[model samples]
Target: MTGKIYIIGLGPGPAGWLTPEASAALEKVTDLIGYFTYVDRIPPRDGLTIHGSDNRVELDRSRHALQLACEGKIVGVVSGGDPGVFAMAAAVLEALEHGPQEWRALDIEVLPGISAMQAAAARLGAPLGGDFCAISLSDNLKPWSLIERRLQAASDGDFVLALYNPASKARPKQIFDAFALLRKLRPAQTPVAFARAVGRPDERIVLTTLGEADPGVADMSTLVMIGATTTHLIERPEGRPFVLTPRSYEANR
Candidate 1:
């Protein structure tokens, strides 16, 4: 009785942004697997066995999920953001492609979730309103040199950037280094947003320019968004100014 596997993105925090499809998938799964905190985010339900694992063990977690599904246990592997975006969706696919051919024939689905960048963009107005790209700042899977080159290329291409995994206790310097690198390529006034724990009770959003941004404010939970040269601010009398990157390229005619 082989079963299916669902890779679900729980969204930035949890229930707030979970898509109805994702919610249903979670409910249907006999087993839920993911990072410890992400697994805990699911509300307790009957008959769902949750498998919580450590950080940086994505491949192991994914393979295990596939195995469980092959053994007839419907499974859902959760990711905090959209599974396709620097998350478990890729890992699951990688495992399927490399693990066992039989695993490929099983029904597999990727349920989308609101990415942290999307949550950050909404909270900070529309910094990603225009042409933009998302990049993972963590070099755990790739080299730092490649990341630097990509940063420079994004700056050169004049695209607003949404950087994920910007900082963590283990690799704190990368975020600061990234900021420093961008400091040289872009103007000092390029707006940088540090959105921490979006959608969570302790969420924080700090907007600052590249010139005066304090990297110290960011931690593992922060998602950083850097505006392009054309990105601008719109004043609001009541609250903080809104950020927008014009969707049109018509040079302010």
Candidate 2:
């Protein structure tokens, strides 16, 4: 008999953000598979076998999980954000679609968890209150031209943009170039936020405007949110300003 696989998102960083469904699935799984860092997050147990691999081997990890499930071992593929959002759920489904027929028969479930974008937005006050879209700045899987096209369209549409994987050591210049393009389409005073490691101990949130935004402040862990034309800021006397995109657009017209 074939066992099952549950692809779960562990949330942005903290265990508190993990959904009850994801936590329940994790407790039932016999094996866990994911990027080494994510896999290491789960505490070691007597029966659970953890399989950690490199970040670049998503397909390989999916296949391994599938193979394990076929051998009657319940597997959990852990991801950092919501598994359905640019995460392991798609990778696992892609593997099942092309892998052996037996793999297709196995039971698979994808449990949702809080995404980095959601966590970041919560920390800043409701920057996603209005129309919004999320995009990954990492071009490892797709072309940079395509990324630019999407960014342009989103800007033109006045959609609040939640940019994932903004910058890394290797791709240090892309964020600056993106800022330049956004400046052309959006106003200089458009609100921008760089939320890094939300929910983690080292969490940092920087609120600024597009004209004054410092791309150097971003890194791989940062989630950059560019507010729409209607977005506004509420300055507080005690803490950081609250960033929010108003829900009604009729008032702006």
Candidate 3:
């Protein structure tokens, strides 16, 4: 019997946001594996076991999850944000393929959840309605040069961009480089939104412009939203802060 391995995204951090399907998957899993902080968010489920680890040990954690699945133990690997976007899905898949031949027969499924970019865009209101792209500034896995090229392409294409893993302890200058590239193609006044600790108790969303969105606004947990060429600032009639991205299709007519 082949064991099933599930990569599940827990969303930002409120249990109420967990989907019924995800919750049901959680209920069926014999073992849960994820970063320590994310594991703490899940409520205790009957007959579920957990494997938690510090954030630094990605390879070790992936191996552990694969091992459990190989042993015919249903495994659920959790990630806080959407598994596909700068999360565990890639790492888990990479490990399974490269680690050993034993992992070839294991059944692996990736389930999606609310990404921080989607959640933050909702708070800003229609900043990504038209054509858009998402990029992660962290160069831990990919080279910084490739990240720069993506930034330039998105900027030149006038695609609203959602940035994840903007900055981290080791690579503090990544956001700065991204900002420079965007500024070259995008106007300095292009609206940008920085969301920190999104959906959590201490959530903070700041509205600013490209020139004003310095590296100070970024950290490991921050997500950045950059508006498109048609995107502009709009003050809510009720005096709230936000921005709007107008669809280019409207201009064609």
Q: How many clashes does each candidate structure show, in the order listed?
A: 0, 0, 0
Ranking by TM-score: 2, 1, 3
Per-residue accuracy of model 3 over 1-253 as CA lDDT, tens digit each: 4788989988887776677777888988999998899988877777899888999677788889999999999999999878888788988888887888889788998888889988888778888778899898878878989988898888778789999988888878889888888888898888888889888998988888898877677887888998887888776668556677766656832
Q: Give per-residue CA lDDT, model 2, range 1-253, as digits (tens).
A: 5699999999997878989998899899999999998988899988999999988799999999999999999999999989999999999999999999999899999999899999999999989999998999989899999999999999889999999989999899989989999999999999999999999988999999999999899998899999999998999999998998989997964
lDDT of the structure predicted as candidate 2: 0.93
Could you tell me how far off, in angstroms, the CA of residue 198 lies in candidate 3 after the best superposition? 1.6
Measured against the true structure, the TM-scores of the candidates, in listed sequence, are 0.97, 0.97, 0.93
**Model 3: ten consecutive residues of lowest lDDT:** 244-253
Best model number under lDDT: 2
Q: Which portions of model 1 miss their true places by more than 4 Å?
A: none
Clashing pairs in 1: none
Better of 1 and 2 by lDDT: 2
Off by over 4 Å in 3: 250-253
State the displacement of the C-alpha of residue 252, model 3, in Å, after optimal TM-score superposition: 9.2
TM-score of 1: 0.97
